[model samples]
Target: MIKKPLFPYNPKYPSVADLKRRAKWRIPKFAFDYLQGGCNEELNLERNESDFDNIYLKPHYLKTGGEIDMSVELFGRTYSAPFGISPIGLQGLMWPNAPEILAKAAAKHDIPYTLSTVSTSSIERIAEVSDGKAWFQLYHPTEDRLRDDILNRLKSVSCPVLVVLIDVPSFGLRYREIKSGLSMPPKMNIENIFQAMICPEWGIKTLQHGIPSFATLKPYMEKGLDLSQLGQFMNKTFTGKVNMEKVKAIRDLWPGPLVLKGVASEEDMEGAISLGVDGVIISNHGGRQIDAGESSLISLIKLANNPKYTGKVKIMMDGGIRSGVDLGRAHAVGSEFNFMGRPFMYGVGALGDEGADHTINMFKAQLYQVMQQLTLEKVSDFPTRLIR
Candidate 1:
């Protein structure tokens, strides 16, 4: 018999699609658009999920199964699950106290929860909430002083893994964000105000939490700046690109395991290995940075097939993963570990404080069910069940 998850799982929102539908109805349109939309017609975004359909897993029904251990050891820590919550900017905008809620849940579950450079909750706060198990992703800054300062802060909190973002040389042309006035210096037009008015619960929570600002970057920002000035400051602070020189500089300073995010090709994977990066998360900024790019799964398969780079560095992925079966598929294909952004955000948006716990629990239950049927005993054993 399968074990029941202790976390509350609402039957009405068993699937991520149900949570997304409820989230759309709960939050303001602008917030939901920012959380869901991708760049340049979202072709890459569509491909991310659709591509998973091509992969299949083989189940061994006759084989007797022992214990199923979903725990995975990454960068010296043993997590309760192989998957984690991918960092998202402005999490509080989706639901007030979103980062704190997720961080607390992640701590309780022994899963990694990454805190973004621009997330609403501060580094120290998430460090406290996650019991220092949270990973931090840095959005490369223009100035060496700012970069060094952020690194020093991460060191202070003893962040286990430092993930430096390599994508976003330029922001994507997201039609929904553009039309919704969610662009930098995000404008709250009459329409947005009306939408907020309709969502009284969200509005009340926002009122209690205050408007979502970059809590991590607050110390560096000037006080009493208006929205336009805030946008200008942000544009001037982050360089939006990470070059070899930047990587070298960071490698020299950060003492812990360093992972590169937004890597999508063999060449980049080789470069990350050369730079002594402990791991590379095969991502296209969640299909938000480039629409012409291939899905993250495609990138992972390419790297997995190349034995030249295997075992040299950890290869992980994060795109279009919405279900436990999807998680199984990605792991079987070549990804050592996985992460997801929208599903967790949708969870928080749908159920508020209870959302993060519910989503993590659901993923655990779903993955366990799949593994039990496959007669898979370990997360690393997922590759054996692959049809390839």
Candidate 2:
């Protein structure tokens, strides 16, 4: 018989913040820091969430309302909601089998889940779990053969959308990661081992799932490579910067919808349009890169309002969005869709396999509440409710 989850969605832990608090205690400090830390002073990280408060919505209490329709249509598909799971790397490090867990949840809920190229689960594994509904995020590889191989693997799985990440031209200077000695094969010092011992649940689950590695890239990696070699391999494998030639190459190769992620400027937006990209996710790499950059919300408002980009490409934003209210704020500001990474990880970290389902349910419930309050009847109506 299948076992049930230890804790269901409790009213006491309704918010993502609550899940985060529980996750911090349940996982090792090093792992938690990897999931939560930002680069440099983390100004951009803090600003992403704080800037959402500046947006105000005007409720239409006097207007007539019926049941709210939360479904959204994008790229010839209708998702149950307007939000999706953003790509996150090393997800299994945060919680054992997190990528698979989130993929299953997204498939069950009829929402999109973008799998990171560096995530622990392989493309084939996630494709099976998501029933071919998962999207793939490509980190431009240094070798043409490697890039072509990964894209072909995605195609064999019948992946719907391909999201190319462009922001990480270089790794962020995350101090927490530096201090914790976090690496591909996590540096298991005495302190890290002790921390794991204290978090017995995470430790046991990790053992069951096997030690998290770059599963997606394992086929190409040398067998039984040491930690130092693995680090060197990663550094040599991926070229973080994405130029026009690379974008054009990918556009020419991939037949499905192509989305350009990490777009925070008009130049990048214009480039994506020129390259004939399908969508653009206005993100600041969750403030993990470039501490002095503007928040994703700030970038979204500017891009969404400009007529030049309004109909040119499908606009989505992701960074520091904690709840459905924040989703409403994004929609009000002309964002066609939204995505979140840390929130779903917090859920899985807090409640094991069941966390993904709980987190998605929470988002739906909270979004419905916001719609009722705004006297809105459909997800598309949110833009008109803005108090601009």
C-alpha local distance difference test of each model: 0.92, 0.92
Model 1: clashing residue pairs?
none
Q: How far is 122's C-alpha from truth in model 2 (Å)?
A: 0.4
Clashes of 1: 0
Q: Compose the digit string of candidate 1's lDDT tens values, residues 327-379.
A: 99999998889999999999999999999989999999899999988999999
Tens digits of lDDT, candidate 2, 257-296: 9999999998998999999999999999999999999999
In model 1, which regions exceed 4 Å deviation? 1-8
How well does candidate 1 match the true structure in TM-score terms?
0.98
In terms of TM-score, the best-performing candidate is 1
